[model samples]
Target: MRVVVGTCGFQRGRRIHYRLLDAVEVQQTFYDPPPKSQLESWRREAPENFEFTVKAWMLVTHGYNLRLWRRLKREVVGDRSAYGGFKLTRENLWAWSVTLESASALKARIIVVQTPATFRASEDNSERVVEFFNNVERGGFTIAWEPRGTWWNNRDLLEETARKAGLIIAGDVLRERLPPRGQEIVYARLHGLGGAEVNYRYKYTDSDLEMLASIICGGGWREAYVMFNNIHSFDDALRFKQRLGGWCGS
Candidate 1:
């Protein structure tokens, strides 16, 4: 069991919150790119045992709303003019690899590419997916895919493809979006056991934690990366980590 917690932004000396855990998922990269200095500073802050996992940028995930995208563009590129020219091509993929390599120096274990809900399962998108994987293969890092919407219907094929490409599926306990239970290398994002309509701030009951612990421990995988996505003001993830630590006697 490799437990991880999601962080909203980079904060100096904040690694103490997750020092007891195995890993931390830096969600800042999903919205904005952090400076190399900040990333290296975090690497120096944590103990050698700690690992980092970063969320893929929204541009890569196609999670752009006009206002949010523009805001992110201004923050990242210093101008909105570069936003329109931004394209998801092989070159952009290479750029992402460079960013991940910098993160690798900080001991990042996996790069999570969480697709937006709009990206449905279709043959057209499938090919693009394969191409994206090919482009990211240069960095010698692990890639985890988390697709929303009707993608789970083609779970078998997608799992096979992911395995062949040496990518990991980002499993979650959300309604109807769970990935296959067993894989040699597994990475999961536990967003709480609630329906889609549920608010992000909803706290996880003991039952919810127990169910997730069961799946993780029962799964045949030698190791699993479990990160909490229910980061809505409460420290449910940290509490859950403490509970899981006790259960696993870690």
Candidate 2:
């Protein structure tokens, strides 16, 4: 199996991070996608073998009420209702286009679309999810969905939708098990563990890394991408790579 380990974002200087890991899931793409020119510059700077995974812009996943919307570079005008929750509207599609362009510029193969927990598993939301996935132009990029909250209550529907849409479910392996079929790669994110659904203050222990290694190795996927999202992501990811015997020399 080919296991790729890295942090959600650069934990150190670019050159230093490149030497420590082989992959990275760019978090900036989520809040505000950078210009293609900037992304291209980053791609050119990284080693040819380095892999980048872009996160879909917030306009594509979060609602107007989401606090992160304040961080958007471009202000949303009137009628913000049609903006998020996978509305399949022109605005959301445009956001996806920008996200795709950013990924293309970075030569990234994976784009993670992470929905907020507030996006429930209701009928309207479900339809929006189906429509959004069915109509979007993938541009030969692997789109991974990270559905949170009540979406997991209906496991069958979740797997069915992903299967029909050819989506890989990017999940926190500690909290949920990814679908066993319909995906060639295993995309796992480590978001820390504590009182809340996603806690960033925690640090992973050696035992946690051991269990994580077992989960990915036993998943039966030919390739796996493991991204650490906690505050200690840099150190934890390095530990994970060592555990998997893929250490890149610290």
* Overall lDDT per candidate, in order of appearance: 0.63, 0.83
| Overall local distance difference test of candidate 2 | 0.83
Q: Compared with the true structure, what per-residue lDDT tens digits does model 1 show for residues 1-250?
A: 4445443333324655446456777876767666777778888987877778877766666633676566453244323233211234554554465458556767786788777667767666776677666645546667788877667778866776666556778767534445565655567676655467234566677777777777766667677776666643226556667687665555
Which 10 consecutive positions of candidate 1 have the poorest summed lDDT?
A: 77-86
State in Å the error of residue 106, model 1.
2.1
Residue 70 displacement in candidate 1 (angstroms): 3.0
Cα RMSD (angstroms) for every candidate in the order listed? 3.8, 2.6
List the pairs of residues colliding in candidate 1. none
- lDDT at 204 for candidate 1? 72
Error of 1 at 228 (Å): 1.0
Off by over 4 Å in 2: 75-78, 246-250
Instruction: Write out the backbone clash pairs for model 2.
Output: none
**Residue lDDT tens for model 2, 93-139:** 88888889999999999999888889877767777788888899989
The TM-score measured for candidate 2 stands at 0.93
